[model samples]
Target: MRHDDDGLIAADALDRVTWAMRRAEWAAQAWKDQRLRPLGLAAAQYTLLINVHSDPGLTGAELARRLNVTPQAVASQVTRLEERGHLERRPHPRHRHVQELHLTDAGREILRDADAVIVEIERQIAEKLGPEKTSQLRALLDEVADAVRAP
Candidate 1:
């Protein structure tokens, strides 16, 4: 495919929109990786940690559902975090088969530092997009996601 003026591969309008969304996701992940690497986390791992920290007692299955990932994938990340002593799986109070996730002290500390990185990234993006445009972009993106999820 030939590239358009913006250097994105040329396609029909809808395809170009999808391509732009994909590129934006990729670029965001790359930027997150650059910031997270020095903090001893990958972007995916950081996301997992943050989710567990935010939702304190979610099981792997629950997290997978929330993240739109497979349970197996969430389980693997949980295993890695457990091995690193960043998180722990405790017996669920209500169910025999379910285990509740909790962040250890290290996990909390790392997440606190990661939040600073996330804030700085948001600031940079807002500066690049301009405050008004950034807010508009966020609303438009949320609308896009909501539209895709609509039946």
Candidate 2:
């Protein structure tokens, strides 16, 4: 007789690769959040800041697409970050209905600090996994992500 995970899918149905990835994600997020807490940044907010910093002119809709989130979600976060003086939106040069995103000086400073923290986190992971394994892990994770994103 085949048994499931007690009202859930069968035990064998929980593929190890997926579970391991999920576990790592949860752990990494918790670790990043804990470290970023002193800097007043959540994982998602830090990600948003990084995106704006990297491109410096993405509209909320564009950001939503990049972040794989809804425009409404991006809007509220943008509003909140703006209120905190972390970022600002200026009217788009060509599009009246769209606003371009930019990080403020404060945003730049905080992002710099947060980046240092994140670098340390990455260094630790690399140290734990060693260089070769770390590279392999990154490639494997990217492949998994690509597979999931592929229609």
User: TM-scores of all models?
Assistant: 0.88, 0.88
Per-residue accuracy of model 2 over 51-128 as CA lDDT, tens digit each: 999999999999999999999999999998999999999999999988999999999999999999999999999999
lDDT of 2 at 51: 99
Q: What's the distance in Å from true for residue 138, model 2?
A: 1.1
- Specify the highest-lDDT model's number: 2
Question: Residue 95 CA error for candidate 2 (Å)?
Answer: 1.5
Clashing pairs in 2: none
Per-residue CA lDDT of candidate 1, range 38-74, in tens? Answer: 9988888889998998889999999999989999999
